[model samples]
Target chain A: MNDKKWIIAGIVVFLAIFAFPFWYNMGKAAPAPEVKLTEKAKAAKQCVMPTEYMRAEHMQLLDVWRHNVVRNAEREFVNTEGKTFNMSLSNTCMDCHANKADFCDKCHDYASVDPYCWDCHLDRSKENE
Target chain B: MNKHYLYALLAVIVLFFVAYVGAEVFGLRIIFGVLIPYLAVIVFIAGFIYKVMGWARSAVPFRIPTTCGQQKSLPWIQPNKIDCPNSTGAVVIRMILEVCCFRSLFRNTKMSLEEGDKLTYRWEIWLWVFALAFHYSFLVVILRHFRLFTEPVPFFIQLLEKVDGFFRIEVLYDTIQTGLPGVFLSGLVLLAAVTFLLLRRILLPQMRYISLAADYFPLFLIFGIAFTGILMRYFTKIDVTAAKSLAMGLVTFHPTAPKGIGGIFYAHLFFVSILLAYFPFSKLMHFAGVFLSPTRNLTTNTREKRHENPWNYPVPVHTYDEYEDEFREKMVEAGLPVDKPFEKPPETLSDEKADSSA
Candidate 1:
C-alpha cells in the first residue's frame, strides 16, 4: 500500500547480486570436453585409461602420477589396458592433445576451473604449433 | 547470558579447530575441501532467503517511525527530511545512509551517571569509528579473497587490491610501508576493533548486564578466523596455489585436495564455513532486517491520512427512529420536541388502571 518502488528496486538488485552464481550457471553446465585426438595419438593403440574412466577420474590419475613422478622420481605409468607410458602431463598428455587452448581449455573454462598444472608445466604444444 | 556466550564461543572454537585438525592431521580432506563448503553455501543461501521472506510477510500495523527531528506539518515548519522522512524519496535516502554509513549507529549517544546523582549523555564516536573500521576492513578482506576463486582475476579486483594494499606514508625524510602490502592492516584493525568492543562489553557493568552469548560468540568466532588467517598468511605460509586450486575445484564441483596444504588452512576454512552456515539463523540477519525494520522504514505522515484497517469488520448499529420510538412518552413529559406527537387514548379506564398499578 505504501510507495515501495525503491524498496522493490533494492530487492531486485540484491537478488541479482545474490543469485549471481545461479544466473551465471543457468544454461551453463560442466561441459563434456570433446577430445580431438592428434594424428599420432589416434594412430597409437592403447590410452592410459578408457574414455569413460578417464573423463570421471582423470584428476585422480594425474594426482597419482604427480606423487609417483615428483616425490619418488619414478618415470613409468602402467595403463589398465596393458600398456606403459612416461608419467607426465605436459610430456605425455600434452604430447598427444597438442593444442592446449582447443583441447584442455574447453572444459576448464566451462566449469570455471583453474588447474595448477600450468603453474609449473608450460604448454609447449601451443608454441610448437 | 554469560554462560550461554561462553559455552557458544568455546563450542564453536573447539568444534571448528577440531574439524580442521581432523582434516589436516588425519587426512580427512574430502569433508573439509568439498562436502562441508558445499553444505554451508547451500544453507546460507536458503536460510537467508527464508529469513528475508519471513520479514517481508509481516504486517506493520502502525506509524511507528523513530523520528529524531521535525516532522512534516505546518507549511511554515522546516522538516528534517532524512531524520524524519514523510516521503518515499526521503526514506530512500535515509535508508541508503543507514545501510552504507550506519547513520543511526553514528548518532549513538552514550549515557552514564556522573557524581552519584547527576546523569550525563554524550555523542559516542568510538563505537561508530571502530565499527566502521571493522566492517570496511572485513569487506576488503572478503573482496581480496575473490582472487583465489577466479582465474586471471578481474581488473576491478586488482584495483581494489591496490587500494587495500596501499599503506605507504611519508614520515619526515622517507616514505615507508608500515604494514604488510595488501590486507594486513585491515585484518589487524578489524581484530583490534573487535577486541575493543569485547572489552567494552566486559568492563562496563551496564553493557555486561545486557550482553548475551549471542553477542560474544560471533565476536570470538570472527576473532578466531582472523587470528588463524593471519597465522596462515604470515607464520605457517600455507601453499596459496594449493589453496586456490582447492577453492577452484570446489567451485567447479571437481574438488581436489592438494597435498601439504596444512591443517591451519583447513581450520581457517572451517571457521569460515561455520560463519556462513550460522549467518542467516542468527542476529547477523540484521544485515537484511535493517531494511525491513518498521521503526526505521515507515513514513511519518499519520496526520494527513486516515489509515483504514483493511481487516475491520462491520457491526450492527441502533437507528435514531428506533430511539425516538422508545423515548416518545418521556420526551412529552419533559417538554422535549418529537418528530410526531403521542396519541392520548381518551385518558380513560386504561390510564386509571395504569396509575393504580404504578
Candidate 2:
C-alpha cells in the first residue's frame, strides 16, 4: 500500500476521535439520576402538571411562567383541573421541590442542560445554609 | 421527478416507520436502541477501513496531480504553491484549504453557449456556500451530541453548546410562551443547508440529470434525521434524561433502553445508524477518499524526482546485434556490411548468374 504509514495514522486518528465516548467513559456506567422529591412534594401527590409532562417539559413550563409573571404581569396560573396557583418558580414550585441540588440539579447535571433559571432566581434552600 | 430520488425517499421513510413502529408499537427498544446501533458502528468502522485500504492498495505510478497554475521550474519564475504544489509542505497546505474551505469547489464555473457561437463561463458560488454551511453545521451538531454520551460532559462540549446557542432564540406561540429551551442555530442551519442541497439536485436540470439514487439517499436520510431531531427538541418533546441514559449506557457498554424516549427519537437514531452503515459503501466515503485522491494529494514534482511505473518489469527482446548475427550470411551475400566475416562465404547473386552461364 502506498503511504502505508500515513494511511494507518489517519485511521488511528479517526478511530480515536470517533470512539472518544467509549474511552472517555472507560466502562463506567453513568446511572440515570434519581430526582429526590421532598416530603412536601411526596405529600402533595401531584404537581401543577402530570409527572411525565413535568419531566419532559418543566423548562418550557418554567419559561412560560417567567414570561407570564415578569412580562405579562400575570401572577395566577389556572391548571387543567381548575386549580389556581401563583406563577413563581422560586416561591411556588420551590415550595414543594425545595431542594435544588437533590431535585433540579440531579437531572439537569445528568442531562447536561444548563438552564438559566438559577441566574436570576435565588435558591432559598441555599440561603438558609 | 426522478424515480431514483422517489425510491430513495421511500427507503428512508420505510426505515423511519420501521424504527418508529418497532419502538413505539412492539416496544423493541433493545433492538432499535442497542443492537442496531452497535451493529451499525461495527459495520461503519470495518467498512470504512476496508474501503480505505482498497484505495491505498491501488498503485498510482505517476505524478498526476491536477494543477491550475505554474509548477516549480526556473529559480526566477514564481510557482503557485497551493495550486500546483511541488513540496510536501505546500501540498499539506493545499490539502488543508481543500478540505476545510472547499477551495476547489469555490472555483466552480457554469458554462453556457450563447447565440452565434459565443461561449460563456460564469462563476457559480451557491454550491460552495451551501456545501460549506452544511459540512460545518453538521460537524457542530455531531460534537454537541457528545453531551449525551459523556458522564461529566467535556468542557469543550459545553463551550460548543454555548457558542452554538449564542442567539438564544426563545420559542413562543401566540401570547403564551412555551417552555422550550433555546434553539441551537447549528441544527437549523444544517437542516436549511441540506434542504437547499436537495432542492438543487431536484430543481436543476443538469444536476438532476447527473444525480443517481446514491446522491439523493443520504440527503433524504439526513433530512429525516434532522426533522425528527427538531421535532423531538421543540414540538414533541421527549424525556432527554431517558435519552441521555440510553446514550450513556450504549457508550459504557451497559446497554439499557429506558422508557419514555419517544418514537421520534428512535426514528432519529435509526436514520443515523443507516447513514453510518451506508457511509463506506457510498460517495460519502469521500471523507476518507479525499486524502487518497491522486489528483489532489500528489505533489507536482515530476521535474525533481523520478516516478517509476509500478508495473514496469523486464521484457525479453531481440537485439539488433542478435538479428545481425543471425542474418550475417544473407547480409554479406546482398552486399551489406557485416560486423564479422562469415567462416564460409556465401555466394553473391552475380556469382550465381556467372555459374549458371558457365
Candidate 3:
C-alpha cells in the first residue's frame, strides 16, 4: 500500500512537471478558445470611488455628534428574514442547524450535502439539545 | 500514533483519493472539485471574522509585552530601542518590519556540533529564503488575482502587474505574455518552499513528534491547492473572466458556481475549500491568534507600574528572614554564618561594639 502510494505520488509529481510545457506548447500550436476576463477583473479596473462629494461635504463636529448621538444604535437582530429571535452568529447558526427537523435534520432530511465543519460544529449542536 | 499524525495520514489518503481515485471510484468530480472551493472561501471568511471577534472580545486587563532587548534607563546607558520598542510609533515600525519582512526570523540560526566538538550556530539562510519566497509570492499571486475578483481591475492591481511582469516574454502566438512580474514563477517557488517546510517537519523526528495532524493537514491541503492551481494555469486553462466573475459574485454574496468550468477546476476548488474550513480549527488559526497574543500586543509598562493578573490569588509568602530563623540552628551546626550571634558574651549585644568595631 505504501509503495503504491509512493508510485502514485511520483506519477503526480512527474505529470505536474510535464503538464505545464505540454499545455503551453499545445496553446502555441493550436490556440485554445479565449476565455473572457471575469466581470470582477473588469471591476478591478473600474471599481474606483464613484465620487468624492460625500467626503467633500463635511458636517460640523457638533452637528455630526448630534446626528450620531440622537439616533439609538440600531441593533441588528435577524438578517433580511424578519425572524425575531435574538442570538449571536454562531449560536444562531447552531440553533437552526442542530436538529433533524430544525437544521441538520432538515438538510439531512433532504439528503443535502453537508461539509467537514459539520463534523466538529455539529458536535456542539448535538450537545446543546 | 498521535491523533494529528492520523489526521495527516487521513489527509494524504483523502488527497490521493480526490486527485486520482475519487473521480474513477465514485464519479463525484464536482463534489471533489467545485463545491469544495466554494465552501472553503465561505468558511474561511466566516471563520476568520468569528475568530478575530472572539479574540477582540476576550478580556486582557494587563499589558505584557515580551522584550528581548535593554529597556530605557539612565542617560549614560543606551537602550536597544528596536528590540524593545518603548513607544507606539516604534512598536508600529517593529510590527511592520515583523509582518512584512519577518525581520526576526531572517536572523534565524541552526546550532550544530563540529568535528572538534565545538558548538556552531550556522545560519540557515535557505529557511529564510523559502519563507520569504512563500509569503511574498502569496502576496503577488493575490494581487495578480485582483483582476478576477473585482468589477474593474483596480489601478493598483494594474500597477502591480506592470511592476511584476515588467519583462514581457512575448510568444509567437502574439498574445503578449507577462513574464517578469509573473505570479506563476513566484507561486512555484512558494510551493517549493511549502513542500520543503512540510518535509522539514516530517523528516526531522523531533519536529515530527511535536507536530500534530493539524500541522500536516494544512501543509497537505495547501500543497493540493497550489498543485491544482498550477494545473489550471499550465495544464489546462479555464475561463479567467468567468472565474473572476464567480469570485466577485462570491465576495458580493451573490454565489454562483458556473458550469463548464471543468473537473480539474473543481478539484482545485475543493482543495481550497478544505483549507478554508480547516483553517480555524487548525494551527492556521495562528493568522488571527497572533494578533491576540499578549506577548506581542501588550506594552511593557508593568516594570514602571504594578500590574497584577486578575486571576491571581493571594498566597502567604515566607520571607528570607523567616527562612533563616527557621533553619538557624541547623545552618549554624553546618558552619553557616548567622546574622544573630550565638556567643551571648556581651550584654547589650549591640550597638556600641557592632558600630564601633565595624
Candidate 4:
C-alpha cells in the first residue's frame, strides 16, 4: 500500500513537472518549414540498384570451394608443442583460406550474406586461380 | 531525491538563462554551437576509449553465472537447457536472447500481497516496454544520422524512414502547419522512456538509497541532450545542408566548423560528448562488460577434463603414513589402521633394544 502510494505520488509529480511545456504548447500555433534536398544527393540516390535475386554463378563457385576444401580433409588435430610442424589440414585449407575472396565471396554471393567483410579484406576471386 | 532530477532542473534553468541573457548581453552562436561541440567530441572520444580499455584490462578470475532457471542436472529430468547452458553453443544462443530479446527483463515480475493474505506476481511489463523503446529509438536515431555522413543513403535506411512516417497527417490552421518526422518522434519517445527510467530509480527507496553520482550523471546528460535536440527540431530550425556538410567534412578529415548552426545544437552536441567521454568510466559500461564476462563465455565442460587455472601455483604434498606414525598407539587401541604389526611385536621397548645390541 505504502509503495503504491509513493509510486502514484512520484508519477504525479513527474507528470506535473514535464506536463507544463506540453499544455503551454497546446494553445500555441504549429510551425511549418520546408527543407531542400541537394541535386548531388538526388543523383547518387538514382544510381543505387535494388538487390533481390541470387546469382547462379555465385552458387556454382561456392559449390566448388566448399566441396574442394572443407570436406577434403577428414580429420582435425591440435599440437601443444611449439614447433614449425605442418598438418595435412593446413596444407589443404590454406590454399583457399589465404585470401578471403577465394572462399568468402563464392559462398556469400550465394548465401545472401551481403558483402561487408570485402570492405576490409582483398577479394581474391578476381585473381588467377 | 534523484540527483538527475535536480541536475536536469539546474541545467534547464542555467541553459535558459545563458541563452536568453547571454544572447541579449553579447550575441554569439559560434561559441555556443561549434566550439563547445568540438570540445565535447574530443572529450567524448578520449573518455570512451579510456573507459572501454579500462574495463577490458580488469581481470575476472572466477566463473559466476547469474542463473535464474534450472541448471544442467540428471539426464532423465530434462534440464531447462537454455536457461543453464553448459556449453559455448548454448551460451551464444543465451547471449542472443539476452542482448536482443532482453529475456530476463521480459520475465520480470512484481510481487504484492493482497488484503486477504494472498501473494500476487504481476508482470512489470512497463519497464521492458520503456527499455525497448529507449534502445530501439536510440538505434533509429543513430542510423538516421548516417544520412548526413554517407553521400547516398542506404536502401534500408530509406525504407526505415518511410515505415516510420506511415501516418502522414498534415494539420493546417491559419498559415501554420505541422508535419511529422519519424526520427523526431523516436527521439521524443526515447526521451520519455529515459525520463521514466530515471524517475523509477529515484522514486524507489531501495534504488535511490543505493544510487550513486555515477548513476545520476549519465541520465542527467542524456536528458539534456534529448531536451536540447527537441528544442532544435521544434522551436529553432538549423541549416541542414551546412550541418550535413560539416558532418561530411568531419568524416573526410577536413573539419571546417560551419558558422550558422544553432546554439541548441551545440548544447545537444556538448551533452552527447559528455556522454561519450563518460561512457567508458561509468557503470553504463555494462555494454562492453557483457562481452568480456567469462561466466557468459566459458562452457561448463568440467566433466570432460580439469581446467587448470593458469595462475595457480604448485604445492608439495605429505603422505598419510607420517600422520599415522605420530598417533600409532591411539590407532591400535581404537582398532584403526596401524603401520607396525602390533600383535607380533610383544617385546618391551628396552628389551628390544638390548637384544639388538647382543
Candidate 5:
C-alpha cells in the first residue's frame, strides 16, 4: 500500500480516540453509588410516591413542587396514595433525607449532573460549617 | 413517498420496535444493553480498518488534483497556492479548510431556466449551512455524552456541557415543568439540520433522482436516535442515574443492566449500535475516506517532480537494428540504402542446390 506509514498512523489515532473511555478507566473501579438513607427516611418506609417512580421522576416532581410553592403560592403536595406533605425541599424532603452528601450528591456526582437546586435552596449540612 | 426512503424508514422503525419489545416486553435488557453494544463496537472497529486498508492499497499513479485556480507554472505568473497547491504546506492548509469548513461544498451553485430560455446559475448556500450545523452539533452531542461513559467526567467535557447549556430556556406546562432547565441547543440544532438535509433530498428533483436507500437510511436512523434522545430528556424522563450506571458499566467492561432506565433509552442505544455497525460498510465511511482522497491529499507537483507508475514493467521491443537486419534484402530490392548489405546464408545455398538437383 502507498503511504503505508500515514494510513497506519491515521488508523492508530482513530482507535486510540474511540477506545479512550476504556483506557481512562482501565485500573479504576467505579461501582454504582449506593445512596444512604437517614434514620428518619428509613422510619417513613417510603417517599412521597413509589420507589420506582421517585427514582425516575424525582427531578420533574421537585420542579413542579418548586413552581407550585414559589410562583403559585400553593404549599401542599398530595401524593399518589392521597398522603399530603408540605411542598418545601428544605422542610419536607431534606427533613428526612438530611445528609445531602450521602443521599443527593452520591448519585448526582456519579452521574455528573450538577443540578441547580442548591442555587436557591440552602444546604443545611454546609450551613453548620 | 420514494420506495427507497420508505424501505430505509421501515428498516429503522423495525429496528426500533425490535429493541423496544426485546427490552420492554421480552425482558432482554442484558442482550440489548450489553451484548449487542459490545458486538457492535467490535464489528465497527474491524470493519473500519478493513475498509480503510482497502482504500489505502489502491495505487494513485498520477497527481490528479481537481484544481480551481491557476496552477504553478511561470515564475512571473501568480499561482493560487490554496486551490492548486504545488507544495506540501499549501496542500495541508487546503485539506484543513476542506475537511473543517466543507470548502468545496461552500462553492455550490444551482442552475435554473430563466424567462429567456437561458440557464442561469445562482449561489446555493443552505446545504453548506445545514451541513456545517449538522456536523458540529453532532460532534458536540457525542462529546457531551462522555459524561455518561466516564466517572467524574473530564474537565473539557464538563466545560462543553456548561457552554452548550448556557442558554437556559424555561419551558413550563400545567402539570409538568422541564427539569434541568438548561436547554441543550446542540441536540435541537442537530435535529433541525438533519431534517433540512432529509427534506432537501425529498424536495429537490435532482437530489431525489440520485438519492438511494443508503442516503436515506442514515438520515432516518439519526433522526430516530435524536428524536428518542429528546423524548427521554424532555418528556418521558428516564432514570439518568441508572442510565449512567449502565454506560459506565459498558465502558469499564463490567457490563450491568440497571432497571427502570426505560425502553426509550434502549431504543436510543440500539439505534446508535446499528449506526456504528453500519458505518464502515455505508457512505459514512466518507469520514475516513475524505482524508485519503488522492485529489485532496496529493500536491500538484508533477512539473517539478516525477511520479512513476508502480505497475510499470519491461516490454519486449523490436529495435531499429533488428528491423533493418530482417528487411535488408527487401530494402536493397526497393532501392533503399542499408547500413549492411544482404548476404545469403548456407541454408539458402543448400536449398538452391536441392532445387537444381530436382
Candidate 6:
C-alpha cells in the first residue's frame, strides 16, 4: 500500500479553500436586538415622521437631514405632523432618544453596522455611561 | 487582427473609459454601478461555463502529446518523463506543473542574429518572471479584495493583508509615514509587466508579425484596471467603508451604489465588469482550456499501447480467406501450400465469419 499523505493533504486544502466563503460567513449575523425607545422618547408626543415610516427608513431621513442641514445649511424640517423643527440630529433627534446605547446603538449594534454618527457628532450622553 | 488595429482597439478602450467616467461624474452611478455590473457578472458566469462545457464535450480521440525526448521503446533508454509523459501519472504531474508553475513558459528561449548570419540563442527568463509575477500578484490583489466583499474578513485574508502590507517605509527618521505596501509593489509590478509585454508585441518584429488585436485588448484592459486601482489606492482615496458596503450590497444582490463613492471607482468597476464579460469569449479562457489541451494532457504511450479512434465506423472489408479463395489455383500452380486443398468448386463464402472477428 502506498502512503498518499501528500495527495490527502492537497485534497483537504483544495476543499478548505473552496469552502472558505461558506465557513467564513458561518454564524456571522448578530442576533436581532429588542429595540425599545428611551423613556423620554416614549413620553414625547410625536416623532418627526410616521412611526411606521421611521421604523423602516430612519436612515434615509437622517441622511436627508444631514444633507439639508450640513451641506445646504437649511435647518428647517417640516414633519408629517405639519410641525417645523430644526434639522439637528443632536438637538432634535437625540433629545427624544436621549441614550444612544439604549435606543440608537442597540439597533445599530444588533445590525453590526456603523452609522458613523459618533465619528463626527459628539455624544454627550456617553459621559454618563 | 492586424497589429495596427490593436492600437485602434486600445484607443477605443480609452474612449470607453472616458465615456464611463463621464457618465459616472454626471450622476449615472446606478447604471454604471448596479445594473451594468450585475449584467456583466451574470454574462461572465454563464459564458464561462458554456465555454468550459463546450471544450469538455469536445472529442480528443488521438494520442498527440508534444514529445521532445527519447521514447520509452527500449528497456535501456531513460525517457524524459515529465516533458514527454508516456503515462497517466506523468501526464498529471506535467499538467500540475504547467498549470501551477507555467513550467513550459519558464523554458522559453530567444534567438538573436549574430555577425554574418550566425545565430545566438538566449534564455528568455524575463518574460517568464514578469508573467509569473503578474499572475501571482493579481491573485494576491484579488484575495485582498475579500475584505471589501466580506463582512468580517476571514482570518487567512487578514493574515495575507498583514503579510502583504509588511513592507513599510518611515521617512524623515520615523516622523512621517508613506504607508506604501508590498501589496502595491506587486500591483505596480503587474502594471509594468503588462506594459512590457505590450511593448514587446509592438516593438519586436517577430512578435509584431504574430500579434493581433485580440492580443493587445486584454493587456490594455488590464493596464486600465491596474492604473485605475493604483489611482484609487494612492491618489483619489475612497471611503473604504462605503466601498465595502457597496461591495456587500452587490454580493447580496441588493446592489445599492453608495453615494460619495468617487467616479474613478465606477470607472475601475466598469473595466472589471467588461473584463469578466470578455473573459470566456476571448484568449483569457486559456485558464480553463489549458487543462483540456490535448497536447499537454495526452500521454506519449502510443507505441506501448494500441489506441483506437472513438469515432471509427464499421466498414466491409476483403479478408485473407477471400484473397486465398481468389488466388487458390494460381497458388497451387506455383507450389504454394493451399488451405483445404485449393477449392476446386469456386463457391462464394462469407468473409465476415471466416476472419472478421480479429
Among these predictions, the greatest lDDT belongs to: 2
In the predicted model 1, the residue pairs found to clash are: B5-B213
Write one digit per residue (lDDT tens) for candidate 6, span A1-129: 111353345445744663454455555542234556777778875688876556544655676677677778999998867899999888898888778877877654333344557788878687657
TM-score of chain A of each: 0.74, 0.93, 0.24, 0.21, 0.95, 0.71
State the DockQ, from 0 to 1, for candidate 3.
Answer: 0.01
> Per-residue lDDT tens digits of candidate 1, residues B177-289?
12211234667787888788878877778888988888878888888888888776544555455677677666556678776577888888888898889999998888878
Candidate 3 ranges beyond 4 A from true positions: A1-129, B1-39, B53-64, B169-183, B252-254, B309-358
| lDDT scores of the candidates, listed in order | 0.73, 0.90, 0.56, 0.55, 0.90, 0.71
Candidate 6's DockQ: 0.04
Residue-wise C-alpha lDDT for candidate 6, range B284-328, written one tens digit per residue: 988767877788888898999888877679989999889888888
lDDT of 3 by residue, B27-102 (tens): 5654554455567656766776666655555667667677868876766878767667777677766766776777
**lDDT score at residue B133, model 1, on the 0-100 scale:** 85
* Better structure of 2 and 6 per DockQ: 2
Candidate 3 lDDT tens digits, A1-129 = 012343345345634542332332332221112323334434443211211211111111112322333454433333233544333223533333334344333322121112233443435644656
Candidate 5 residue lDDT tens string, B13-131: 99999999999998899999999999999999999999998888887878788887888999999999999999889999999999999998999999999998999999999999999
What is the fnat value (0 to 1) for candidate 2? 0.76
Task: Judge candidate 2 at residue A105 and give its lDDT.
Answer: 93
Give the distance in Å from residue A44's predicted Cα in candidate 3 to where it truly belongs.
36
| Clash tally for model 3 | 25
Whose DockQ is greatest here? 2
What would the TM-scores of all predictions be? 0.69, 0.93, 0.56, 0.61, 0.92, 0.67
**lDDT score of residue A62 within candidate 2:** 81
> Per-residue CA lDDT of candidate 1, range A1-129, in tens?
343454556667877775544444344333233556678778874468976445434655676677677778998988875688999898898788788887777655533345567999999975787
Sort every candidate by TM-score, greatest first.
2, 5, 1, 6, 4, 3
